[model samples]
Target: MPFTVLTILAALLVAAFLGYTMLRGRRSDEPTAAYDLRVYREQLAGVDRDLARGVIGQADAERVRTEISRRILAADTQMRGEKAQSGPSSVTSAVAVIAVALVLIGGAWLMYHRIGAAGFPDMPLSERLELAEELRVNRPSQAAAEEQTTPVQPPKLEESYAQLLQKLRDTVAQRPDDLQGHILLAQHETNAGNFKAGYEAQRRVIELSGSEASAEAYSNLAEMMILAAGGYVSPEAEEALRQALERSPDLGPARYYWGQMLAQTGRPDIAYRVWLDTLRSAPAGAPWADAIRSQMDDLAFRAGVFNPPQLPVASPGPTQEDMEAASELTAEERQDMIRGMVNQLSDRLATEGGSPEEWARLIAALGVLGDKERAIGIRDEALSVFAGNDNALQMIAAAAQQAGIAQ
Candidate 1:
């Protein structure tokens, strides 16, 4: 039902209760005088019975009857007066009651009209509040218009890739001096596994950036070379990595690739060491660290090597003896301490830069650590660096066999 109607009904119920209470009291205030007459009649009967039984004199009985009749007439007259007064008042009272009821209903209707915009019949309070909020945020903007616009179809991935490649080619032709453009092109080619194109692009970037930016370009080129070299590491690839490491001993890419070459040439211990050292230098999220870790796990699984799967970026914390010995360590103790220190250095190379010598050192460490997977990846990276260099490939393969890694 409508709120107004409910409110009116409630008011009427209250009025009825009050009216009943008032009217009920009126009955008590103006009680019937007939009971007084009955009492008077009973008293006269007693007087008559007394005279008949000779229990009282006739004079005494008559006197008591007269007094009772007089009191009964007086009470009857008062009751008539009260009735005459209340009868007219009841008419006004009833009009007042009806007026009060009409006023209550009208007030309820006014209140309902004021609140009727809330759509109480259908919408709930929560929905009404939400609608109010929407009305308040009525800002006009181009973004809003765009949001309302329909979506357009996008090109397929292959078509998009082709378009991007064409744009890259055009951009490179038009803006030959843009080193970033070349880098982007190289990245795209690398992602598409177009190692030749990627290598050429990286070479251009290296030329443009010169030695200053050559390290990054070299890293990319080396990665692509590894992909291009397949399983055969070559001497030329080895020389390129060596030069990169020579320029920057902390060169992570060169170290990682060289480690792979070592593993491929049957030098498992050397390859494992390279990865272990690389891990020490590599940051937590460095791709080299993750790749090396994966390679290590694979190698361990294949070769029955039990190096920890996912070693920390540094060698596990120092041993008690190493800490206590301070300066005078035994040969074995000294080796352990050096191993730990070297592991830390290699991990730093993975993160920062490394020299060719450091790369070599990392390889030896991996061999000691027994990480075949990293060793193999290093070999693969090396072969790509020195493409067409058979000696490099042979060395890598020999190391792999020696490391007990299957072809």
Candidate 2:
């Protein structure tokens, strides 16, 4: 704090000095040229004295006197010119001082407020990293963070719909171990902006699922928790995301939330990289896709990427109706359908050598089919293909994570 104060004081002093010099410009009776005039006149007198004392001959004295007179004339002209152009007028000087002060002091303050962490003392890199870790560890829990937030207004529902929701909630309360009931309750409540209730139901869903819980379940829990806390990624929410990643590391929503958590915890550089990969691969219109897109420019700036690559236009893929139709198929039929597409993709990628996005999709598809060995091999080859490309590497790594393959 003392050093900051001293630095500010020094800046003010330098500004004062600059303003004074500019305002005082050439406004003096003894301008540099005026002083030169005096020196020339004295030299002319010295020449006369030298002649009287026989220090030089008459011709030499005359020549010296003439040279001094010419210098005096030139100095007199310069002095008059300096006097005429002497600095700005009083009003102009005042305006100039104000402008300088504003640019130097006011501008500095504005820039600092935009980017600086006010009141934070400078620390060594290691100390800063330690402090960041401590903050991550000690940040508020989901419940506490939710308590500090104002609840969002729930959307209006028809009388019949509202009553049906209430009945479902009551049913879940009575049958606390009913996983599907809790899941339905969670989905509806979250849709209605009743995030607190949504997260509560989601917690029960996770508890019942236990080891059987899919990554989507844990990721959904984290999502509701974040929404309940007014978008703050609390420690509890982060734990839910960690659990999701443990189950399926390439889980899109979980990676999205993990990136957000990293940014919140002062690791924006890593978050920037994480989001760059995740955003490109997230299915079009997913909640996290839009959220990540909205935040990428700011995150890129924070990560020192002044000119980040053009954001990928999330390509049109499967529609919700299409996905629902696929979900209706029997297990064997659906598996056969997926296997066919996966085989086609695998062949195309092998022969044609497709995009990073395609390779990532293929890897994730293999993971879904429980083909970890093929997924790992495909991941390795993909890494080799895009060895020097950082963004491609991140993409492959995100998919590789799902199959438990370390980069």
Candidate 3:
């Protein structure tokens, strides 16, 4: 109401000022013929007084009177000419003023109509802030509700595997206290890419473990939830991650997911720092290490850390052919093959002192196998070997850091 009043008052003030200016402009400045004639008469009277006082001769008085009359005539003629010109000029000036006023007023109204909430009530800052807080409080619940309503599409499975899954479900239902069974079911479901089922199974695992549940269990459940949501870091998943991080600060999966939450919430700097720190301590070849490495540069850029040195492209791990060849082997034999490969890489780096990239690869492989101690040792040796080569040393250090090997 105050704003409306002020706006109306402003419009009235402008109009009043413009109208006064127009009226004042219409008045002529030149004197009329009658005023000039009066002035001439006063001068003639002064000359008469001079004659009476014997101050001037009659001839001089006549000459002065003649000059005064001449000036009066010229003034009258000039005033008539000015009057003749004033009419058209005054009309032109008034038209220009009216046009300008119309344009200004019309333009203001048009612009306001187009872009402003002309009739909306003014909201106080406190009220606006309160409304924002309300939205913030409700948003997570709304997202969770939406998630619940959305259907989970499970991956297609062979008939035999499907029957087995059904049997497992029935057995679990029958034996609700079987925590180990739930864990196995969760792992197998996740391995088969049935994330929804895996998520539910993992949730049960946490429930069964109770206060004894490890951070890994919470992190595993969170991972399944995230996968089920197709990578969405839903509020529920975020809570699970928080629980995991609280129990184990150095848990790589929790840190990675937390970093993702930070990024999502528009804190790229914090996210970058978290991911960078996590990568530094992560075991080489760890899945979390690769995930962080893949996104580190972009996150760093967003965090204003520009032109960071590029990390070496990760070497391919076990190929499909390798996996297929090992498929026929027993579980123990498969483990032996992987361990042998890791040892061979380790031995080669220690004996041959390979390129910085090769050293980095080996360190990452060790990290992936959860051998942080060995990874750290390899990093120190690589650093010593590449002491004179700053670029190579940096690459080796970065690879080791990403693998979560201690500096």
Candidate 4:
């Protein structure tokens, strides 16, 4: 009722203001023509004074006097013409003011009826956060239950590979307490695109690891679940990600996925902050870094944060000709070339104590080459070098963890 009263009062104030502006008589302190003529007369007197004082030549003073007199005559004529024309009729002015007030009020009403949430109650921040929390608790369970009842078609695979997978599954079941076996099975299933099975296997790995489970284990489980749900970050997945963050606050995958959850939940401002912070702290070439970088600017703008300048499109990597030339090389030659490049990068970093991003790339490369020992060594060296820089250390550690290096 108070709001309605206030709104009506505001409308009345606007109408009154507009009506007065339209009906008010134009009362100039002095008429425009009269003001101009007075200025011109003053100029003529100044020219006469200048001539008397011998400050100007007589010819120059006469020229200035003539110009001033001509302006005075023009002003006098204009003032007479203005006086002859009558002002707007009082009735006409009243009609115009009324028409304008009605239009403004009626137009505002029409626009509000068309586009405004006329009947909706205000949703304050506290209420919104409560609703979000409720959804977080209830939605995932419902989704998981529905998933269990729904039949899923498994991807086709070679008979031998399928047999091998079944054997691994059987081995994990027999040795339910074997954490390493569950972890291996989970990884293998994920690699084969069997995310549903991988999700189950990863859950078992988390259970077996118990209190020893690191953020990476929980994050991996969350990722598998997301994959199983066709990339939907269900509440269950969100819960797992939350746990991951609780264990390791800067876990890259968890932070990235948490941002995704925030965005999906219609909290763009929070999501923008999360993704931006993650991007700032993330190592270059980290698994999640590129995705976060590509999306952050758009999210920031949507969240009413500053609009970022458009970044130039990056050049495409490794042209067709270059790929073809590389393809022509023997497997051994390619391996040797890659190893050489990796070695050079390692040497440079060791000598120069390069960026955390560079150190992350070196660790990832070693992992890819099946040199977990070397990757671990590099991770340790990077941690020591960046000991005082917590953000850098976190980025490198997360990258190494993602790359399967023992931390």
| TM-score top scorer | 2
Clashing pairs in 2: none
Report lDDT per candidate. 0.66, 0.86, 0.79, 0.79
lDDT of 2 by residue, 1-407 (tens): 55456556766877898888886663554667977888888888888888999999999888888888899999999988887777768888878877887677776666676787667777887996887799899999887997899978998999999999999989988998898999999999998889988989899888898889899999999989999999899998999999999999888889999999999998888999998888767776687788888999999987888999887665445566767978999999889878887887788778877899999998998998999889998998999999999999999999888757656
User: By how many angstroms RMSD does model 1 differ from the true structure?
Assistant: 28.2
Between candidates 1 and 2, which one is better according to lDDT?
A: 2
Alpha-carbon lDDT of model 4: 0.79
Compared to the true structure, candidate 2 yields what TM-score? 0.60
User: Which structure among the candidates has the greatest lDDT?
Assistant: 2
Better of 1 and 3 by TM-score: 3
Model 3 TM-score (2 dp): 0.47
In model 3, which regions exceed 4 Å deviation?
1-138, 141-153, 309-339, 342-353, 356-407
Of 1 and 4, the candidate ranking higher by TM-score: 4
Q: Write the per-residue lDDT of candidate 3 for residues 1-407, one digit (tens) a residue.
A: 65545565566568668866776767656545657767887987899999999999999988998998888788778777767766446577778677767765666666766886687778886885566446534445324643764556666889998899888888988998899889989998897778878888999999989999999999998898887766666678888998999999999999998888777655677889898878766664678889999899889987889876555544435756688999999988987898888887777666755678888888887887788888888888888888899899888878887888755
Q: Any idea what lDDT model 1 has?
A: 0.66
Model 1, position 151, has a per-residue lDDT of 34
Error of 1 at 234 (Å): 3.2
User: How far out, in Å, is residue 304 in model 4?
Assistant: 6.5
Which residues of candidate 1, in runs, are more than 4 Å off? 1-156, 174-177, 297-310, 313-407
lDDT of 4 by residue, 1-407 (tens): 54434455667679889878766654333556888888898888888888899999989987888888888899999998876653576788788777877876776666766876676666788997887777656565525743754445666889999899889889988998898898899998998888877888899888878899889999998888877776668888888999999999998899999998887776778888888777666653466868877787778876888965443332223334556877899998877767877887888787766778889888988888888888898899888888899899888887798779754
